[model samples]
Target: MSGQRRTATRSEHALEDLDGAALSYAARFAEQSEGRRRDHLRDELVQLALPFAGRLARRYRGRGEPLEDLEQVARLGLVKAVDRYDPERGSFTAYAAVTITGEIKRHFRDRTWGVHVPRRLQDLTIEVSQATAVLTSELSRSPTVAELAARLETSEEDILAALESAAGYTPASLNGPVGDDGPAELGDMFGALDADLESVDDRLTVSGLLYRLPARERRILAMRFYGNYTQSDIAAEFGISQMHVSRLLSRTLTWLRQAMLTDTPPRWESTGAPPEPPDAVTVSVDRADGRVQVGIRGELDRSAAERVRCALVDVVCAAGTDEVLVDLDGVGFIDAAGIAALLASHEAARRAAVRLRIADPQPYVRRSLIVAGLAPLFT
Candidate 1:
């Protein structure tokens, strides 16, 4: 995207003035019986059109089409525009711009913009469908962005962003509504009932819930989740810093926890979605339809130990659960309490008959467990 942006930017430089009188004189001579001047003028015009072709290509960035292909399509338009143009028509530049611009937009509408998506990103379309299925089953209500993120074991932001990316090539169109013969979308039957996720209370609860968070937090959630922005992109949008975005997002989580608790009650309480911990304890849990992965990063201070405990408990007890994977892949430090938390969670899983798996344990977490005299049990 950056490269495309740079290529487009190159077009905005100060205008290159062609000596029109000289060009027209040569063109007139070329127009006389079969001659070299017409071909030369046309070739020069094609070269001039190349930069516009590049700029138009960049505007549709992120639609999953290759830039080079779009440029070729645009150049095709430029060629057509150049062919129909007469030097006597206003400025040759203005005449060329109109026909070419229209062609570029039409080209995208037909070949790329909302039609093309790469294989990897196309797979995400399936992931979103599966996620929506899971969330609809669990949440009884339409899932919020935060809830969807929690279920997928990704940040709520990532799930929403993926949905937006998928929207561009949605195998359907938003500009057109469903058939007029049927009732409005929600009013239509979904398995004799309405499966439409947004039809739930018209998303009233989630929107109301968002109003409770701080404005900055609300903006972060909007940018990250809805607009498909990375943290860096969000940082750039607000004209602040990435660290600033990091800090703000941390605080946003704390506020979300508090607000949800105030509005709904215990449903989300005891959730792994606790207050954001310091860099001292970094935990990531990726919950998907078929499996649950729990990853812990950084040192777990004694105070931060419960964060890990509650997280393990949440997934281990989750319904339709498969396996609980403890990824100590990023753990470089640990304390006695952290070790105890793992052991307790493991035992709890045993009682429930939940499959508990620990993967590629990091050296530090391994050393801590061994020194604690618990290594023999797992081995």
Candidate 2:
């Protein structure tokens, strides 16, 4: 369920075909009872399912795990599914999917942790998860730090620190891929070695996506990453708060992720004559820490607003990114179209059940957001 944000609604789309075919083969093998026949069937099923395993492994690429490792974990899950699969229970595709997906998630919870952590931390996590879920069910919507504090009847400062620390302790963000093609699939997380795209070319693709950012973000990203400066150092260079720099770094990372890993696909529908999610705008990406921050700074005149709105919608709507920050800090002015774009982004974030934070509001940005009654939503 980590990657799967949207639940299966229409069964019409059907489970994967190869999985079904594999199940059919297994059934035929069972009928034959010949040793050779069963061996051939099992081998054939493995071959058929190899692609799905790769796809699943791709889903976990940037979550701080190696592709080879994730593939093995997913393969184990697939193999287990093959062993336990009962055609009577459900479609082989769906059943096997559950196993592989679970294995992928378990890897995040168990092995994905790169550093050793205290068992007490795991205990605390379990406690927090249960408490948060119960409180959320009662209160409606994800509980804020303050609301959770009240529920725990503890101090707000403690709650805030706990949340931050909770975030820091994870090996990889467990919320799933930053991008989603459909149902939090593997395609969203990993940039592919296409039929072409030699290894070096992939690096260029990522760099190309980075070039699309506004000059400030691009510079900040380069200095922070290449120069290896802390956000505080970057803040000093730019005369802004470390927090602001941190937020910008996050937004820039998401933009790059959208561009590199996810290829900035056309998730949003343009309202008018605006261009699609070209390299210039609407980069779809998954981040290293698993959270993504995006800044949409271009002029959202009426003609371009609709398309940009759709792109924002895609981010908010997708069951992708555990947390999303959409910064309006760079906008010099705001208009009705711009206001609409922000609202659309906010709604999509909520729908996806992600923590959406909007930071560093310019005067016009604040005014536009307030007029649209989005202050509570963003603040």
**Candidate maximizing TM-score:** 2
Model 1, TM vs. native? 0.27
Span of 10 residues, lowest total lDDT, candidate 2: 6-15
Q: Please name the candidate that would achieve the greatest lDDT relative to the true structure.
A: 2
**Weakest 10 consecutive residues, lDDT, candidate 1?**
263-272
Expressed as tens digits, the lDDT of each residue in 18-102 for candidate 2 is 6567668767977987688787877778777877777878977986778898999999998898878777787887877889999
Candidate 1, clashing residue pairs?
A: 153-286, 153-287
Q: TM-score of each candidate?
A: 0.27, 0.32
